[model samples]
Target: MKGILCTLLLLLWMITGCSNNSASNMENNKKLAEAVKQETEMPLEMPTDFNFMVSFGYGDVTKNVIDTYEGTVTKDLIIKGSATAEILFTADELRDIYDKMKTIDIMGPKELSKKGNCFQTPSNEDLWKVTVGGETKTFSWTDQKCGITEDANQLRELRNYIQHMVEGLEAYKTLPEAEGGYD
Candidate 1:
């Protein structure tokens, strides 16, 4: 009887030891998967010559931002099958946008799309994207209400700011022809 009891204790010890080993292996595998994803992803950069780009759909009436700038900006818009319009956009604006966006944690994977049931929630939602250093980060909210989380306010502000920037373009033409426009 004593021998049988001793054998049972040894078996239990072995089982616990094996489970701990399994847990460690799982943690290592998770880390490896994250490293692989980072290594394999394609890099995105904001091109210096990126004079014009569509901000995509986030507004009610106007569909896209149009560029009146000549050279690569014009050609790219044409290729995208859009009728370009002359508007005020400057490197300063881009830099400002970059500064605002760099504060958001966009280095990790993020879900940019959200779905809502019409019956469940009658609220309107919009997705905003800002591209910098060739990378685009997206934020979406229902109407202008952002969300219930702490981070939602920051997101709402950024969205409102971008909306203002895009809307502000309508007020002026060619940015008063600054020294070398893009400079």
Candidate 2:
């Protein structure tokens, strides 16, 4: 009877020890996961002097431009109705732009395609100039509907994104309606 009780007590002790070890292991695993998440999810270090300029519409004569360095938006009509508005972007907004630029590898290449042709007469144009980390890249392309290069299409998307963002801002909304229409 004593032998049986001793064996049962040893088994119980072993089981308890194993459960404690399992709980410790689980805690360690959780800590490791949290540490990895903290390391990976850390916010990116934004550049100190970042500037972006996007001029879009029917060439330069009938275009609207949002220039961060100039802190101005120039809204142009075909010939006569041109207006300039003061604008400012908050730090958070700039950070968001930086994040988006990084996502699209804007600083990596001037053009993603080597051989692509686009053609349109008096076609709308999108000109993007971005400066990051003291390096500048300028991209110019025509309307996507005119069958532009792949890189130009990417720029179009970027331009559209910025235009949409600007349109939602109070400054853009306050601007007077464009006076004339392009023929």
Best lDDT goes to which candidate?
A: 2
TM-score of each: 0.47, 0.66
Q: Report lDDT per candidate.
A: 0.47, 0.75
TM-score (C-alpha) between model 2 and the true structure: 0.66
Error of 1 at 50 (Å): 7.4
Candidate 2: list runs displaced more than 4 Å: 1-43, 60-62, 112-118
lDDT of 2 by residue, 116-171 (tens): 46545666787778887666778776653456667777777877887777778888
> Judged by lDDT against the true structure, how good is candidate 1?
0.47
What's the TM for model 1? 0.47
Clashes by residue pair, model 2: none
Model 2 CA lDDT for position 102: 73
Best candidate (score: TM-score): 2
> Which lDDT tens digits does candidate 1 get at residues 1-183?
999999999999999999999999999999998896675343344346333233333233223443322311111122233344445557788656545644654334444433443332323344454444455545554442333333544555665675567556654333233222110
